[model samples]
Target: MRADPKGVLTGDHYLDGDQACAEGALAAGCRFFAGYPITPSTEIAERFAERIPEAAGVFVQMEDELASMAAVLGAAWGGKKAMTVTSGPGFSLMMENIGLGVMMEVPCVVANVQRGGPSTGLPTLPGQADMMQARWGSHGDYEIIALSPNSPQECFDLVIEAFNLSEQYRVPVMFMMDECVGHLTEKVSIPRPESIEIVDRKWYRGRKENYLPYAVNGDLVPAMVKAGDGYRFHATGLTHDERGYPSTTWQTQEKCVHRLVNKIRQNAENIIKVEKDNVDDADVLVVSYGISSRVAVPAIQQARQQGIRVGHLRLITVWPFPEKMIRELAGRVKAFVMPEINYGQMVFEVERCAAGKAETYLVPHGGGWVHDPKNILQVIEAAAA
Candidate 1:
């Protein structure tokens, strides 16, 4: 991590949401950005390309999203913090390589500014359809960190956190952006250096002979060494053992899989994040995340005005859903209402976390429009009545 002169730097400039994302990556110590330009998300690449050179970093426009993702992985392996940005169609092309990153345990960031999809359903429109796909699209049992930003300022802040978590845990973190966030214009404050805390990838300081690429240390996160730092370690998609060589033995594979999954799963308590409101004493709970949470907030307020015992939980990290927090609410609240831009994605998680302790309902709709919280208030009212 590069150290800047102390004190926060505030800039007052008119910029688009995509520009904020790129700027966020740079502020977070990202030195490499590779991607193909796609609508609604293209501005991110364009902005990064122009800004990276000023930071003495490299920005390359690849031929396709596949190459873009591959290039980022390659850059990360070379010890440079790297990232790529894409929309729905481009995300489709990057999935296979995403799985490769997961298997190899690469540390990088991928910003998906989702437009309507299922083969380019709507290029300029907004949708949250990728929530399910973000967790399962890579085709494996590995864990991923996904952050959904409801505003441009969050776009800037969360991208920094994404890289920090990615390097900290050695995983591919996803910045989940919908059309609203990707297109929204808002003032974002760029904090001073003292306000930003950057985490560098842990490097092994032990003797060369003692280094094992896949060996389990106490934290389960093995220290990483660059490819040419005399580490001489192998990395591949196939299951591998401590020495980084492919292992066909079921025992080794089982251990490897368990560690890979547990490294993130076990740390979920640290990973889960949420925004709660008036939840200390409530009869009904409203669960929502991303831009949809913006709508639900007002609904929660209106319900409170009517003397309905309503509360809310706004999820910040969607992947490792805040199960524990939801469970606490389930025990106290009478019902849970989930509103989202998609038909239903996070609702299932809420249901699972509730564990039959409370009734869970889905208020679902999509197509670039924000969910109406009135539907949620009604749910709270009916459940209370």
Candidate 2:
């Protein structure tokens, strides 16, 4: 249950992962949800469909993921906090429009509850297979926020953060959850409204006279105006100027694209987040995220009990990769090991951050089963030896 700032009862009820995701969005002031049905991820849409009417919001089941994602962008432009949830297959369909969201600077959330894939390998099974895709699925050079949750509670929390980042950066933030977290039943404590920090999209409040949609002012993010609020602005897939008008000039095109890119690229330091445990005097730093992080805790503890100086660093924000922290840890630790479902996704980021200062290794496994920490112990032994 959550209370308004006034401490009124919003509602208090126990919910599974899917239900909790919907409640999280509602609490975060998301008024629109558009998605297609896909297992594990489907319950999120179902919950939203049932709750939105009560929340005085809109819920739409689009014909496909592409349209569903498109509708989310449209809804956000119409001044609604919007989101869509889908699994691997539907997420593939949503990629083109995901690029559109990036190009348009629209604020929206796309939750990818990942199942095994390379074309529907497993519809109802777990996989951390979407980590790399989140960074590269959409075409073009652009930065995006992607958060991975290890547990149902973090799923709810990260969804809220996803909405905040989407609005703050004017980009589509992705909540990347594996089928394990999406289907797992767990007790998640919904905080009071006062406990939540909600960031609404920066809206144009000053005189709308001569408002440039892509204006490069002192603030990197410009205040956005609602589409139907009598603010006439043109949105395009083409290279455009600050006035949101198409530009034929090369210089103008470069300037527009550069600002859009730097607005996020430069803010990498402020956006990246990771959770560290007993790392100060550690010989090995275990790098993991999402559901794999759950396995890492015990691995670190068992290693510690054996007198190995091992620690864990769990990435909460998978994108905007935590380069600085990883770099700092590389100087301190003997080796950095990545345990993920994928063969080698974030392991690349770790190596980049390590820059040969520390040895990096991959303990990867996939196709429905999670990477066990016991395998990680062997890597620790090798590094220690």
Candidate 3:
């Protein structure tokens, strides 16, 4: 579907990541936004609140982050393509409902502009430390789609992809942008309304008398029906069956859980996205994502100048983690060096995927800022040695 011109901020302009994200959501047909302002990420909410009126959208400033997340899910099921924005503290508050959204198979976007933190860590600074939290903060077994944007341009482009992915899979998509990206200004060219491709809601079209809320139709995802849409269906936070009815029986649990996990697992290839450079003949691969991936470019160039066979793999989609690519590269490379602005989150995934076929190393940083190219180079040099 083409975007509606009313929401498309057409033409090129200098935009920070936060503003670009807001514009991207509007351009993608987001008709509702619920958010609580927080540093580094607050601009996203502010932009939406200011522009939504003109775009024929609803922007709500919820009392709290908890309410904000709950509202995002409600808005989604209410037939509005919805989203919410926040930083570390707010992102933490949204975890439980994030789990709820997963269980209910709600299609929404949660944009977390990360800051340094265990709690309210560095409100005004950058952090990639929340990468693990995005994966496991919401207790329970489920998979999510997460995207990392390294620039303001991507901040605009990836949100559209995020929303499209959410609707495509009937799941919540995470837009993970660190503080640096959110605050950094760069050029962003928004295409014309006719040029944008949008994925609309996968609405149920079955006869109302025989509707099954969670019934599978060839694909793992069941089509959805909006509230007050003259269709009878049920939605809940509890484990449910095809009819959206709760059943404590082991059989019901197995069916319910398997579908949630398998829907993503079965379609992993289509969801996984990565950018690679010089990996074919490289002896060491530098694996990074978000801002850290951009920071690694200089270190990679330095290594190449020093006659080292070092390659770069930037993860565009963080969740569903590029397991297959890592596994394949492990068999070819001498080692994989991962640099993330945290003690270590994704490095563990690389280690698991590498499975001892090759060595895996983590270049950890404790947030507030990005890693120095020297640090990454040191690790690459050691790995190359």
In candidate 3, which residue pairs clash? none
Which candidate should be chosen as best, given lDDT against the real structure?
Answer: 3
Angstrom error of the Cα, residue 363, model 2: value is: 0.8
Provide the overall lDDT of each model, using Cα atoms, as 2-decimal numbers.
Answer: 0.84, 0.84, 0.93
Q: After superposition, how far is residue 59 of candidate 1 from its true place, in Å?
A: 1.0
What is the lDDT for 6 in model 1? 24
Question: What lDDT tens digits, residue by residue, belong to model 3 across residues 199-314?
Answer: 99898887898889899977889999989889878899888888898877889888888888889888989998899899899999999999999999999999999999999999
> Cα miss at 175, model 2 (Å)?
0.6
For 20-111, candidate 1 gives per-residue lDDT tens digits of 88878888888999999887799899988877767788999999999999999999999999999999999989999998888888999999
* Clash pairs (backbone) in predicted model 1: 8-192
Residue lDDT tens for model 2, 36-109: 99987998899888878777889998899989999998999999999999999998999999998888899999
Alpha-carbon error at 6 in model 1, in Å? 12
Q: Tell me the TM-score of model 1.
A: 0.95
TM-score of 3: 0.99
TM-score of every candidate:
0.95, 0.95, 0.99
